[model samples]
Target: MQDSSRFDNVISRPPASGDIVPISAHPAEATSAVLHRQIRHDFPTIARGEGSYLVLDDGRRILDASGGAAVACIGHGDGRVADAAMEQMRSVAYCATIFYTNTACEELCRYLVDSTGGHMARAYIVCSGSEAMEAAMKLARQYYLEKAQPEPRRTRFIARNQSYHGITLGALAVGGHKTRRQLFEPLMPQNVTRVSPCFAYRGKTAHETDAAYVARLAAELDAEFQRVGPDTVCAFVAEPVVGAALGSVPSVPGYFKAVQAVCRKYGALLILDEVMCGMGRTGTVHAWQQEGVAPDIQTIGKCLGGGYQPIAGVLASHEIIDAFSKGTGAFIHGHTYQGHPVACAAALAVQRIVAEEDLLANVRTLAPILSGLLKQRLGDHPNVGDIRGRGFFWGIEFVQDKTTAQPFPAADHVAMEIAELGVAAADYAVAVYPGSGTVDGVSGDHVIISPPYNASRAEIHTIVDRVARLVEDYFAAKNAGGPVDAKL
Candidate 1:
């Protein structure tokens, strides 16, 4: 029988006809049966985490290149964050927000609102980005009802194509990811209309200038609003820097300004979904900052708590809060654990660490270096079509034909294959976040390499080197007609 321990139980070798092995003999099978993301695959058991590496049960340390969906802003095993959570637990770990509010929750909310320089007057803490998005959508609906004019017809939302908000039904309704929503389409709300995203790579024409492309996209959004009836729209939802949906794709200059203008012209709120790209991931505290416009209602997560605890939030502008105060005197939404004390404490510590340590400065200092390294190493590679991102959040879009920008078929599963190979390979020893359907919602492939904001120059170089080598070797092996190890 093949040694399951050797491969970290990532994959089991097929047995010979004459050989028989019990299912229980597999290392993963022997371990606790946690319902993992994939039921068929034997995933590696992560034993521990330190710095920016995840140590598996087999003692192999995989460098976390993507921060587990871009969450670990301060890296792993942060003592201060842990201590904060512990302290909060000792005081009052759980509190029903409706009955009473705790100090941790209040403080965290204040910190978040203050971080936005009062642009966001209130914060509604939630458990995950999906929940935050759901709250944002619901709040927008409520906001309209609270208005003096009370346009009850404003029940629709306008989002961009190929964009991701979150996974909840309301969020999924607003999101434009075709694959995620395909299975749950019937259950989703039919109140969203999508326009073309500001994806310059695939959406921009060869002869078009950046300004012209932005104008074109703006026009598309305007047309969609017209098609759906502009006054019927409550908010225009988008991610300032498109995250996993389009591989860290950022909009062109003046794109957000144009979109915001359209939203303002129609009296619709601009909702920025910054769950992945916000909280200093893009060198700014808010991803929308660089876009020259602020979101009327913004959802933030992932790096907000830096994965220390399950936490996310929606930030509302003063206008929205004033409307609620004057009309309803309260938001109608409530979650049992809306402001869980422990989660708030951990997030507070994480955000404090981000501010005190001046990690945003580090991100700004290292952004150009990381970008330069990626371009220097993989720019000329045939399969590497585009390298785009800001700050510590970078993505490399892979192409089947670089000249024509033709993507590999969806069946290829190129991004996931690269990610699996990267983690399993001994030499590369890195973990990257990969996603598909970059083109439209079913074709292109890309991998994100967003290391922690605290990663040093040496760590950044290591990440770049390993990622470059992994991509190069994987494609080289395929071109040579050798069997590619990764099946999925």
Candidate 2:
């Protein structure tokens, strides 16, 4: 049991106020008014970015390994997206969706729906994934009201345990992260319930077959629907691939199909939250493409605008839209920036770049190479418990005992330390996305590495090599009773 605190130096911190602070110090001195994500931790000031790397204010070049939470799909500093947004701004920056819809908005929506092969007939563009999810929930409720056999009691939603929907009140209510919800539990709505996620690594029995595992998970969903009263559930909400909360764990084959069946049996809509996994991050334009099941309502973000502008959207099936068209001709919810011309333009440009560059093909071709490299480097490491994901969206879960798959205590902050070391280590400068509560929403540790879609094969290899070295060095230092890294 090594002390986690001994690794604090892994992340460079800025000097205290009144002194000339280092560029990496917390950006909040008496002169600084910015409210940072963490008040106590030092934050590095980013100066600029290139293709797949970020330059710190002090000129430290770090590879954008996880794309800053997998949002920067086309890499940073794309002139095309910026130009598109500026072009839209010059034409029309803001238009109320209720009154006027801009061409960019309409075109972006058309592109999204068309990409779905007409399965998703409508699109509701918003500012964030949370907003998209919130919109989806509202639409589902409104859809039932428009139905001939309207079930007014269908206000509840059934989501999965260890799943992450979003940060807003409605979105958070459906999320199952125990830690994020602990303080806000009293404030969140009580209409949502949770069932087990298809986490085969820990949830499945050792001898269970894939089919049996899928069947068991489907049974759990079925039982949950019965317990909650099928007629009372508006929808069954889940991520096509569990993100953030459970590490990038994709469902087994036939899993989504089985869950969709359960939702159909219960007469509840199926809502797939692809905020983190959709929009070509998983090689396909839509992650559900590989699953062989279509969601009644789908939410997408992250890669949608490639971090050029804040944007997310909801895609609804023809049936959901028809209900509104026939009943009220309107959805009851609206956002001030629901269809901002600038956001839509940026997203359109990003999507166009993805298509023109044929990046999805690159993802499909390179995903196996990255996976193989990771396994070759760290598969036998004691802390490497599981390596799972599809396409370029991958997660590496850390554990205390590999044989038992026992996670390290949350207090150790294993994943966070690795991420910090990746950036702070003089030899290996790469950014990664780290998360906790991978086991039961309070105890597991994992880190995600989702490089930009345009990341070259050499860059992927470099990213994996750096990640492996960081892990090995961190533990080697711990065992030798030293700092977390050799050159931190």
Q: How many clashes show up per model?
A: 0, 1
What is the lDDT, from 0 to 100, of the residue 472 in candidate 2? 86
Could you tell me the TM-score of candidate 1?
0.94
Per-candidate Cα lDDT values, in order, are: 0.86, 0.86
TM-scores, all models, native as reference: 0.94, 0.94
Residues 338-369, model 1: lDDT tens digits: 98999999999998988899999999999999
lDDT of 2: 0.86
Predicted structure with the largest TM-score when compared to the true one: 2
By summed lDDT, which 10 consecutive residues of candidate 1 come out lowest?
3-12
Shift of residue 32 alpha carbon in model 1, Å: 4.7
